[model samples]
Target chain A: MTQTDLAAFLAHSVELESEARERYLELADAMRAHHNTEVADFFMRMAHESGLHLEEVAQIAAENALPDLKPWEFDWPGEESPETASYEAIHYRLSLRQAIQLALENELAAQAFYASFAQSSADATTAELAAQFAHEESQHAAQLSVMLKELPPDDAHHREDDDDPHMPE
Target chain B: MNDVITFKAKDYKSGVKPIWCPGCGHFSVFNAVTKAMAGLGMNKDDTVLVSGIGCSSRLPAYVDSYGFHGVHGRGLAIAQGLKVARPELTVIAMGGDGDGFSIGGNHFMHACRRNVDITYVVMDNEVYGMTKGQASPTTPMDWDHSKLTPHGPGVRPFKPAALALAAGAPWIARAYSGNPNQMAHLLAQAIEFPGFSFLHVLSQCITFCPQQTDWKAIVNERQDAALEDEDEAARLFLHEDGFQTGLLYQRQRPTWPPEAAPPNDPDLTGGFRL
Candidate 1:
């Protein structure tokens, strides 16, 4: 990998963190709309943590002029960036524990992504940076796991029943 | 790249959380629309989105731009009027399959024939998700889950792309929500085209039609290249399955509000005074 490759890799890293933040914010909004304030607040906190990660990535990016790439140009192992949460996995009645679990899964995926990149990169600097990023993602995942354990056991049947359904009367 | 103002996809969002169900395909479409708008370097103030009643109609609220969440099935009519009144604005009309093909079916046809310089994006989820799991105009003949249609709708589904082609729309295309980047590219191209453009998006309703989650496996890129000839387009549309996604037809045509007349002209109504 060359300087250009490193810049591209950093750009992707920045995007992954940014997307994760955005996705969490969107989930928080969705939860609020569903009148689930408890879960919404939890999601908001997760989003704030993701924002801190984004700032760190931005600080690194400030050290180098990252290449501007289109949303489609990034070569992710999956259909989208590794840390971006799946939109389909959200439910209006989702529990706080479930939300944290989802974030934990995304953090683990991000960790795995960086680990693979570090192993595959031939350039020493790129490999070292990837390893460092992987370590940071592992820490985030560990923190989320601890947060999940602190939450009360989720009751699968604790969903609020709508008095007036949206179905045709 | 000199003087090019770059924008990220998130910059186009309104920051208002979408209330759409988790796993809903509309989320991808929303993301794609914003990406397309940003890719075009469109001025948020100069762009407007209009939509009728449906789950997909909520798209305008999520996009940070001028929008109108109009009455049920009248999104196209409102969009056309706005486009005519303010031709400089980039007007886009969006709704679900039921809103466009059933209640607002007539407006859909005329909007295409009128050739207004507006883009219409119909998120076809087959079933009416907003009103629970009811069969919509695009629902398959064999979909028999609805109590109202215990034996299924038993009618042929509406073919949106072919109908748009027949109705004189100059640009017609289909995209899948499963591939947001490709959808964004298609949307950008549709917006740039100088005629009435119909973008049919195969967005799935995960709650009502959970089986459609397999669309990621079923949808395929169009093997045949985009057709510039009307006859060739018609042949391709008629023969191919609806799962093929890409620009199917495009042709240069005269748009509405033909060159404006000089402002100094005498009032034509003066001669007709009674």
Candidate 2:
């Protein structure tokens, strides 16, 4: 699980972005089910960002022999890829504020993952690559943090859409 | 078709994204299925997803592969026919517990006995999710959440893996939705198995059975390794509470229709082949 070489580290990076993109798309579609179009669109935009990053990493590593590690084989810090949102956090009525906060937290976690590798990896080239990824993740987190601040002060507590969760009769 | 070097789970996904509830376990299963397909390098044009009616039956709509969204409880029958007609294509049949064990119980039994070269996956949520949450054939006898079964179904649930082996399926495995990675691993193996392979997925219907979230802590890996002996597997299934997940049994046999099937009879087939 430890990234001892550049190929392994790049593989992990690609996996992280892939997972993040999938999770965002899931959240967006789930929100759409509850008619939360605004939040859904926001999540879609985040997914696009992740997709772009994933493309860049994949394009460069297409020729490299990235190890095809099983899903459980990945040595992720959390239960899943650092950038993937927690399943417990998903809901049909998730508010835009909560969605943004969740994304921000995931970005921070990804940044931390790359940062730890940058500091602990013994291989100099791998460490440098991890550092670059860490910087990029930090920027993503900062942007999300700003989005969080710009929302209404009470939005943080706005996890669920309305007080009632019952379907209309 | 895709090369291993170009493996991408998203490539196996359709244009529409899955939209299950907040705590719904199907999300994980969906991801696991796509990951498994990508890992196997399955060709979208050659891989077929057949399903009966239910929440899980909607799976075909989410995958980019060829799909046959058939009527309720006929998934196995249809999938078997498809695989027999086109032996070269990879066929996967999937649906909910209600559809597979109740309405299609007869077909399920025969599918196991016939030993067709296809995969069958049952998303056993233990409740009829699409019909607003009623106790399913696999619902616990003690479960009393549904008003219709407020005092509990008071009926023993169908033991899927045990039943599969009894009916003569060559491969049987149980997987938990809480562990998508493990589910994906098992799925790839089941798909590669060259005979009737049944994978029972304990997918939680969080919208109705919110308590199922606790399955994360309750479910455990099987204590014993994969068993090839039917009697040993039977004894294992009989004693366990069915919370254990892993490859419980495998006994490959020559697939059905030992030779190419004869020309289809329009009377029986109605000239409608999958």
Candidate 3:
């Protein structure tokens, strides 16, 4: 169901940012465990950005009396929030460029999600809030795209075999 | 206004990163568990999670609740003991297919027969993931991946839902980890059920059984309503393909530790006296 009020809209936004932050942190931890420090650091920075976004959403939520929706109660378009990266898209050997691309795609999806809400919301206040969120997400997407351009392209030979593959005998 | 403090799914997480492969379906199972707990408004301190040895067994570590990473195949026994001793605690026993059906197979049968008030979640990946890639009890007979088996285990796979029905479990449900939202709903229902509840989660191990990635397209939600009668449930279970997801059976039965106390015996402590 479409979020019709400011409280419901902010609740969705908070969840979206929080889940994205947690997923990015999880990816960073996994990358570090795999000894890919460069990619790990990149994911960590992305996670930090998500954390800041979460704080911003939380502040907006505090300004309004948000309804506490259970995890299963939200009308998320998918199984999870739009900004959270799909677990299947991550790999232990992911490159820095690929990581940035993943973040960029997530930002684009979040932007689209808020844009749709802004257009479809029935309540005037909800629509205005959604539009503001959508504009912020659009800025984030633009910034990510610019950052993606600065990263070096992935090399064809960069896919190295694990020296100690965790394979069963 | 409801004064209850609501929690998000992340609140149930311990913040420990799972060491499983990046895309392993176990990640979704983890997410589902946390979501279920949050949905139930369950107090983490009052819940206990137990697991046997396997990749899926590492779940307790990731959850921010009371947990026991017990010895291989003894998760059920430990969980049962905990439930009997502290009947107030919500206990959930979990492990991989091999850990639950092979080494702990007998316990699975007894747990069902006893109808204890606990939820057992078996992450059925059909292969032994932690051991690199061995043929598990639920692996299809024709699967020939392991050099050890060379030509597969040459035995029919174990049917968990049917076995639970035969063993007398009060509730049985199947879920796919890829669909975390549905899985979370099923898990919450299982936890709230009065007696023994068996939740069979088809969590694919991408590293060992990469072909199972197609399971996303194959798994169909159960069309028939959950059956209360044993005969009808058994018939529906036998007729459908194993990939069907959703509650298959539910029948209320007397849980263990019956309210009526056993007759007092003077000789009860005689055997224990040295």
List where candidate 1 sits over 4 angstroms from the true fold. A1-4, A35-42, A93-101, A120-123, A142-169, B1-7, B260-274
User: Residue-pair clashes per candidate, as listed?
Assistant: 1, 0, 0
Q: lDDT of all predictions, in order shown? A: 0.85, 0.84, 0.87
Worst lDDT run of 10 residues, candidate 2 chain B, spans B1-10
Tens-place lDDT digits, model 2, residues B1-274: 5563555677788876665665577787888888888777777888999999998898999999899999899999899999989999999999999999999999999999999999999999899988777889999898887778887899999898888888899899999987777888899999999999899999987777767877878888776778998899899777778888988898878889798577667486666667
Clashing pairs in 2: none
Q: Best-fitting candidate, measured by TM-score?
A: 3
Off by over 4 Å in 3: A147-153, A157-160, A163-169, B1-6, B261-274
> What TM-score against the true fold does each predicted structure earn?
0.86, 0.85, 0.90
| Model 3 agreement with the true structure over A48-119: per-residue lDDT tens digits | 998998898899789898876777778888767899887666666678888888888898889888888889
Q: What is the Å distance of residue B48 in model 3 from its true position?
A: 1.1
Expressed as tens digits, the lDDT of each residue in A42-120 for candidate 2 is: 9899999999989988886786888877665677875578999866566666677878998999999999999988988
Error (Å) of candidate 3 at residue B60 is 1.4
CA shift of B2, model 3, Å:
13
Residue-wise lDDT of candidate 1 within A1-169, one digit each (tens)?
2332678888988988887888788778778877889888988888898899899988988898998776766777776788887755666767778888988889899999888879888778878889999999999899989988888897767754554222332
> Which is the winner by TM-score between candidate 2 and candidate 3?
3
Model 2 residue B37 CA deviation (Å) reads 1.7
